[model samples]
Target: MNGQVMKKLLKIAVVAAFSFQSAIVSAKLEMIDRVVALVDSDVVLASELVRRTNSVLQQIKSRNQTAPPLDKLQAQILDRLILESLQMQMAKRVGVRVSDTELDSAITRIAEQNNLSIEQFRKSIEEEGTSWAIFREDIRAEIMVSRARGGSVSRRIKISDKEVDNLLVQIDNEGLSRVQYSLGHILLPLPEGASPEEITKIRDKADKLIRELRNGANFQEYAITYSAGQNALNGGNLGWRNASQLPTLFSGSVKNMKVGDISEPLRSGSGLHILHLIDSKGGFETHSVIQTHVRHILISPNAITDEKAAFDKLKLIRQRIVDGEKFEDLAIEFSDDKGSGSLGGDLKWSDPGTFVPEFTKAMEALAVNEMSEPVKTEFGWHLIEVLGRRNQDQTEEKKRERAYRILHNRKFEEEAQIWLQELKEQAYIKIIDEN
Candidate 1:
């Protein structure tokens, strides 16, 4: 669907069925397409369905995966197109749009993600058969669908504090403090009738064994040769055990020991034991995640202020931010997203999922204290800044945040299907049989 010819073909067909009359078009041109399906006030043309089906087939082939029967794939893709058409209609009804600035930013992100310059990405797309013009419209459609989906779905999915608290309780009861360890043990046992002198001999032997293991002596080899523990035959290899499952004495000692470190003699009533720190897992350190502290000046276009004016205003705001004007003051004075604007545009410390995809991407790419050029979204333009960032420990704040997300996601999937089903049930949809 990407080459120059298809690009021209698709561009023509995509634009209101290229909106030319088929009789007139056929009179002048050779190619003709028919409606495959009729959506509420729109049609899914045969050309568009074939184009998408081929794209899916090409993707499957590229991945070396077996393609499904053509009939089945077409049905699925046709259903998908029907849904998109429904959503696009909704978008038009609501005045949701993909502005040129927003489209350009999205394309830039796509190019960057592919590790290609804009020119190269364009060249690659055209070479592959999709014209840049058609490609842009496709991206615009994608963005619109996303906005539509979010607008429809987000309101239905809400996570309560009570839900988060209950989940955290469940997680806590399931042992949040446990860490697992794989260890090697060597036991120098005391003879049953051993005197104090005999105990000293075992302790010294344990100390000596630890020194040897520390200085590159093979711990498993030593365990098999000199240890009297039950696992001594298996090179004293204590396969993975949680902290609570470990020997009372070895449990506390292993927590502070680094992997590969052989402990000093852990004197249990039965013997003087030596432990090797083989490996550990599932500690709090693993919960570290980066969170961004970000803020922005948001401005929206209205009848009085066009998209250009909105964008131009944000550009000046960003430049002032770069040149040392306080972002908070400017945001308070100028931002149209008044709720956050009153707070100096401070969205506060947040994960990337806090905002729309475009905002998330722009925020993720900024450094601490750095400002971004105006970025576009459905809401309009924004001049964003990364106030600071941190690899925060997963404290209570993080746990609840994650719990909220888990509950929200679980409900979202269930609700989104219901929402879409309702959309279908409520919509005017008719499929034209090829037969």
Candidate 2:
């Protein structure tokens, strides 16, 4: 054969090999970025699902938590991705966004919390086999989801004053008000306006679940397999919340159950729940609540008696009281407060904010059964007596404020779960199985 012909054949062979190698590389990229799930107008890529699954697995390991099956974990991660895509789409529609500056600040704050610099944080993330770019995307996505969630869930939470007061009553009775419970929950959601038959069926399922959970069945696995709660993917972890912070339905069950004890199926507005008390920490917490039983003898300055006469009358009245004269008698005869005077000037037990600022200060300063000097209030010249002081009284304002927060959080949790379920039910989703 001619040398030219041999060289030409060799060059053609080399070109064909290079083309085949490029084709292999292209296939690899396609496999990595292939669509695993379609969520509304968005797609979750294979690479994303893999990354998220690995991250979750690592987190579970770090926390010493038992993970569910790989297939279950993957499905959970894919569902999460689909939900996140839906949220991001909603965020875009509503103009909810995290600016680059805000995102940077969030990242900086995370790093600071972890006691690391940005560069150090980047290195740490990369060391865990995640790219820095992907981590930023994760952070951005998290912020967008949070904003979207707040917009959707905040409106659903309506804490009525009566509801708050009810919660306060519960809190007051709760001996473990500040004790935190780390719970695992499995929700068996009922259909809207479910029939009695349906309710009984769900209750049976919940009861079975509680039995299994208490009898050494893997809670995380059961949760991933059956739970309808939003945190089902995270092994139904509701994380940590104090008794007051727990949902009203849950708080009652939790206080009596010991750690690792699973509650019998409990029903709420949403559905039946099987609760696993993963852990508990903390003890009783109480606020200093001081109440003073006070009585005031008010002598108003009238046209007949000038301010000086009123003041002098109060002084004389106070002197008479200090000289062992009957306060009730003086209050009835001279006190302008017709109602209180009739009751021996008995104001009963008063909370801190019950009185005017001046009156409250004077009352607060007086010891039990101690008489105050003639103090001038908006009412008139006053002779005040601290009949008794008690610390067990509830501060209505603070207690109500705490109750409001607890109710809001409970509402938020319940609402978010329902909202997510509705979102998935409403959206167009398609999962492309790897198989």
Specify the highest-lDDT model's number. Answer: 2
lDDT of candidate 1 over 7-118, digit per residue (tens): 4446556654544555475665444666788777777878888887777676556655555457766776787788888888787778899999999999999999999999
The Cα error of candidate 1 at residue 401, in Å, is 1.7
What are the Cα lDDT values of the candidates?
0.77, 0.82
Q: What is the lDDT of residue 255 in candidate 1?
A: 77
Positional deviation of residue 156's Cα in model 2 after best superposition, in angstroms:
1.7
Per-residue lDDT of candidate 2, residues 1-435 (tens digit): 534334544555665677668778775322224567767666777767888888888877876777877987787778778888888888878888788899999999999999999999999999999988888988998999899899888988887878877777767775446578999998888766789999999888887887777789989778876787778867789898887787778888998999888888887767888888989998655467677899989999999999999999899888888888999999999899999999999999877799888888898898887888988888888889999988864556666777788789878877877787778779989998768
Candidate 2 global TM-score: 0.65
Predicted structure 1, TM vs. truth: 0.48
Displacement of residue 341 (Cα, Å) in model 1 is 20
Clashing pairs in 1: 2-129, 2-130, 3-129, 3-130, 12-18
Off by over 4 Å in 2: 1-21, 24-30, 188-208, 224-226, 268-271, 283-396
Model 2: which residue pairs collide? none
Candidate 1 residue spans exceeding 4 A from truth: 1-31, 173-394
